[model samples]
Target chain A: MAWVLEDGRPIYAQLVERLQVQIVSGAYPPGGKLPSVRELAAVAAVNPNTMQKAFAELEKSGLIITQGTNGRVVTEDERLIRGSKRRLARRHADAYFAGMEGLGYTRAQAADFLRAAEGKGEAEDE
Target chain B: MNELIEIVGLTKAYDASHIAVNNVSLTLPRGKIIGLLGPNGSGKTTLIKMLNGLLTPTQGSIRIGGQPVGVETKAHVAYLPDRTYLSGNKKVTQILDFFCDFYADFSRERAVGMLQSLGVDPNARMGTLSKGTKEKVQLILVMSREADLYILDEPIAGVDPAARDYILRTILNNYDPNATVLISTHLIGDVEQVLDEVIFMRYGHLVLYTSVDNIRERHGKSVDAYFREVFAC
Candidate 1:
């Protein structure tokens, strides 16, 4: 997955978001090995210390764990994946509804939009 | 690994009574970029000179790669002094040849690439180049080496903002990861984001030596803001 950096936000926060998205999407499947700090820093074109800070933050949140010499690994805990997915879904719904309301759409109209979205999803699956 | 550069109770005095660098002890490890910061006449140059073996310390010792600062250490340390060190009559290609002959670690390809990218003609004499271009050439030479330690004093000083960024990027991209780089400059704000650690000097004394993260955590401010507060007149 591609990394996106939002303007004015701290780089570490963006890194955390990117990793979380990867974990929730199963890109970094359960027990997968994450890239080393030097590798990530080179890829991101950032300082190694900045990448280290991001890794430390991830470790603190229990999303990943590092083993000596073996490098960092994605945690296999299912609960973390479920929780992150729920949080992301809720945020998306909130933003969608807020935008619809700002554009003068009623609750009923928003529900209709969701039904239309379901139809499009089914069509794409078929 | 042992300290790549070590200074123990080091002091420097230009005159008999006036001290440039007070009693200071510091151990700088390899493979890290160190930012030596201070205001004007804060002994930053003197301290850097001692590290580069340009000036002998009045008291104490400086060891590089476990050996005392001498001809052996000098060979391993690439230094760019605060003031101009090259004569105007010499061409850029001549200096490059000189460095390659004198220092075993000088990389000719890297120097040529950097000079080309910087728009510095290799055949142009130092006297013919503009001040900013000259500074860029100096930086290119210093960073082209695969030395154990690289000491640069006021590398970006007197350059325009655009050239300053170019100089910083060159230093960042060119150096060997295992080499230690000590850059001494008063422009903290310009270089704070790239610094892993900072050494602040004041009135010939080491006022502070700490990581950028620790400083931010303690002061709730960026290193630039902390610097203004600490060095304000």
Candidate 2:
């Protein structure tokens, strides 16, 4: 499926993450119309009811707005989108560190490894 | 959402001996697809039969739309048994007419439209079509109803993956928004994504009533994987 769901998390949570990324990353641009619950549900291969719950979460976070029966639209507020992006980045970093910790690596080592990998790519470009 | 189905202390026992369905109480809300799941001999079939009025409960009660299971309730519920109850020597079109004559809610245009899409020959006899095609036709019939509760027993059991997808989509497209669809199946993986909630049964007892996503979130496993672990021998 286009939407990948990780294990050990409610679909609502995964949906929130995926849609948050979509909004912040401009896959769903600010002020763009969001797919209806049924459309999104079919795309994700989930029940429409579950999809509704996900949309409700997005609305609560101010990442999407539902204007009566006009359906949902991505929030036009740039600050909200930026906040979502920052929060998502921090969560990703925390997860990366946690996974590295499982492999017996310290936060400093993980950061050094990431920088070294980025430098190698830059050097290849040069 | 109102309670579409309410079962209070429901049980079905044979001769006061073997309990097919133990005393169970549950309320299924409208406008959701609920999976009734279990292994062999888990009272799943019995529970469904009771809901559809095919078999009367030995004790307690089942209420549909605030009314007990009876003639009025039967009108509001559409049931697709594991076997195609409509199979006959007649041609496919004739059977469509039969359903239209029988079920006031059956829509001839919708059913014929689906049949046309599937390329089912209207003149073909029921015995002539392939097993998969016949299953698809039967599914189309069940979904043509505008009933409040749809009880589908093993709708995806024998179909191929492509046919299964078509069947699930047909169900999603044809349901009334306020209706409840209770599908009984062992094919958990194929149907999990479409189910809003799941009811698990074992040995004629209600074991778990949970959402498919809840199972994923809490156990880190799909409904199929969890079923395997829960019913492991």
Candidate 3:
């Protein structure tokens, strides 16, 4: 995923969110070795110190673990991964609902819209 | 060991009317990519020159690694001036040789590798290359040195957007972790993400010096936005 960051938040906080999404979505597979702080910082075009800080935040939540000298890896725990995935999904859904509310759509209408869009997309694919 | 460069009450007065820098004091630790930011005529260049021992401070003192700025400190600092001082008649290879001869820490192989990657021809004359390419060559030369501190004055200002990214990447990937890189620039938005800390100057006075993330956290805006607010006319 593109590490597009906004202007209003801490860079490390943004990095933390991006890495969390990557881990949960299997872009960085469970048990997969994460790139070194320097490599990832170059890729993200951010300071390595900020990347290190983000990794520390992830390690605190058990989403990733740092080995003594071998570098860090995404958590291999299936349950932890699933929980993180669900939390991220819930956050997106909450944001969607809030946006739909601002557009004068009720929660039921929003759900129906999702159902309708999914069915229409399936029909078009067929 | 933590503090790589220290400045206390540093001031540079050109005359009674022109005070370029005034009573600035700060300590920069090693392993940080710090942004020296300010509007035009804010004494950013003057402060950098003083750090490089090119300009003597009228008041106060600067100690790099506990030693005053002189020959010893000069050997530890790699400076890239805002303007090009490389001779137009010299080929890229000759310039590389010059750096190798001048700085004991300069790595010719590393410079060559970087130049090849950037598709810069070593046989080409300095005057024949584009302004952006010249700046890239200068940056690569400076970065190839294994110095304790790198002072780059507006390294990215003369380059294009894509080249800016390359410069930032080069800075991120290169350099020793124990070395401190101090880059002075007005393009805050472009370099803010790459910077660990930033020192803001305003009309020869030190306005603020803080971590980049701290600015976003406290001001609820990016460093660029906050800078506009702080230095707005």
Candidate 4:
């Protein structure tokens, strides 16, 4: 999976977001074992403690659960996955609206653009 | 609970006016890699020097393995200074022999292997090698010894990225699991991943010393990020 990091955001939070994206994208299927902290850190070229913090955040968010010896595994709960996706969508929406506002576009104009984009997305899906 | 090295109110002064290391107290345990981080002129070098008996503490005492720093403790300590200590005219073989003679724990086989891997000839004179090669040779010599404490000061400084990787990998591969390695450097981001604990020093005083895990938990930031924030004026 690709590691996406923002300069302003904390490293661990970026890690958590990357892991979440992977999980929601089905790269790490439900109940599948996630990579160890060291392995993830090596892959992302980040500190192991940062990876550990990301894993802990994942656990706290109920997206993953750790089992002794078996290591951390993706949670089997569909609701948790959907919730994360919704949260991600909301964050993107917020950013999109904020950008539109900065560009002097009204809320109605932004909504119209989003609707057109959604229609194009539906056509592509079909 | 497992204190391998301890310092209580350790203070070192070069003169009556200037203090190199202020009243510092800390305990370091075995089986951990510690990053002694600070900018230049910060007492990291002085503190490390005291640990190896290169300099005498002016006021306080340091205990290694429950005993004070002395000649006996020197046997168990391996030190790699920031500056080049080996003579430029000496051959690698001559240096190896000197280490073997002076340190009982020095391993000739390991030194040869490390040198061979780096494409360094034991017969070659130190003066002929590049600066990076010299640093690698120095690291090999220090790591070849089976010491309880390895004090490395700025091992990656003045080297290219590739050499830095090799030096870091060599330290990781050669270090004894039971021993403690204290590395002092200003390059925190590069070595932060491997470090178990980090000690931050500012102007000859230790500002922070805590586990990496604790730092992340408390600050919600990577050690590098936290360092930038802490040191930012």
Candidate 4 lDDT, tens digit per residue, A18-79?
89989988999999999887677666655565677789999999999999998999999999
Candidate 3 lDDT score at position B111: 96
Interface RMSD, per-candidate values to 1 decimal: 4.3, 2.0, 0.8, 4.7
> Which candidate ranks first by lDDT, i.e. highest?
3
Would you list the rank order by TM-score, best first? 3, 2, 1, 4
**Per-residue lDDT of candidate 4, residues B2-30 (tens digit):** 78899999999999888999999999998
Off by over 4 Å in 1: A1-46, A56-126
Q: In candidate 4, which residue pairs clash? A: none
Superposed Cα deviation of residue B27, candidate 3 (Å): 0.8
Please write out the lDDT profile of model 1 over residues B1-233, one tens digit for every residue. 74788889999988878999999899888767789998999999999888877899999999999999889988899899888889899999999999899889899999999999887889999999999999889888988888899888888888999998787677667545678889898887677655678899998999999876678767767777788899999
Output the better candidate (3/4) by lDDT. 3
- The CA lDDT at A24 in model 4 is 89
What DockQ does predicted model 4 obtain?
0.15
Task: Tell me how far the alpha carbon of residue B205 in candidate 1 is from the true structure, in angstroms, after superposition.
Answer: 0.9
Better of 2 and 4 by DockQ: 2
Query: Which has the higher lDDT value, candidate number 2 or candidate number 4?
Result: 2
Give the Å shift of residue A118 in candidate 4: 6.6
TM-score of each: 0.75, 0.91, 0.95, 0.73
What are the per-residue Cα lDDT tens digits for candidate 3 across A8-105? 99999999989988998899999999999888988898899999999999999999999989999998998998998898899999998999899888
What is the Å distance of residue B75 in model 1 from its true position? 1.0
TM-score of chain B of each: 0.96, 0.97, 0.98, 0.96
Alpha-carbon interface RMSD of model 2? 2.0
